[model samples]
Target: MSRPAQYHLLSLPDGSWETVSCLASVIRCRATTPTVIVDVSAVERLTIDALAVLVRKAMRLRSAGGELLLAGPGPAIRKVIERTGTGPLLPDFYDSAAALRALGDDGRAWQRVELSEGESALFCEPAQSPYCRHRP
Candidate 1:
């Protein structure tokens, strides 16, 4: 039989470009993991750019035989997900724990993604692009 899939848990701060870049690095490091559950409770609002990041990552993960999940989005964010027609692309759960349970945790200790300042890089688009406003 194949090996059991490993689950990696990460929490996003907000839907800013910074968060998107941070997520890009974090997910890159843990790309081999089968499941990535991102805690979005801290995100007050998910912007289109941020949503694009999630969708792109989710598609990449799915193609690699893995999955990405959004957990703990508020009502407004939920509406955004549904209205944007990304509900099916990105599976969301009530909370991280619920997501873990749905994936059959088996009590395994999962690794949590921590953001490092030095590794932040812009993954959205060319930083010089005038349309990308959230640059630092």
Candidate 2:
């Protein structure tokens, strides 16, 4: 089957410990596409625990033959990633467009699925798990 021509976006709330914990739980239960992008543009501050969540997500993706790219992290966030020595493990981009190109996206407007609390999951599976709506 052909890969989905889009990137799934998991938008962070505030990069707080509580929010990151919630995100980690949701991700474990939900299956995402091979190319998932975690957008941190809205994150005003950066925390070590929060950055750990991103690294953990990336490791999971790699095991499943996928990749996780961070998008729109400011200098503060970048410093944490570097300080934590996860820069080599986690590749990031200044924006989604740059990330798309790096992933070989044809510069077309691909679809997106933004994950957040309160809202329905962009990709969710039942226990038996026949399908997920956010494939690609």
lDDT per residue for candidate 1 within 12-103, as digits (tens), equals: 98889767766765665434464689899998888888888898888867766768888898888899999999998888899998887777
In angstroms, give how far residue 81 of model 2 lies from its true place: 0.8
Clashing pairs in 1: none
Alpha-carbon lDDT, every model: 0.71, 0.68
TM-score of each: 0.73, 0.71
Report the lDDT of model 1 for residue 30: 30
Q: In model 1, which range of ten residues has the least summed lDDT?
A: 116-125
Q: Give the winner by TM-score.
A: 1
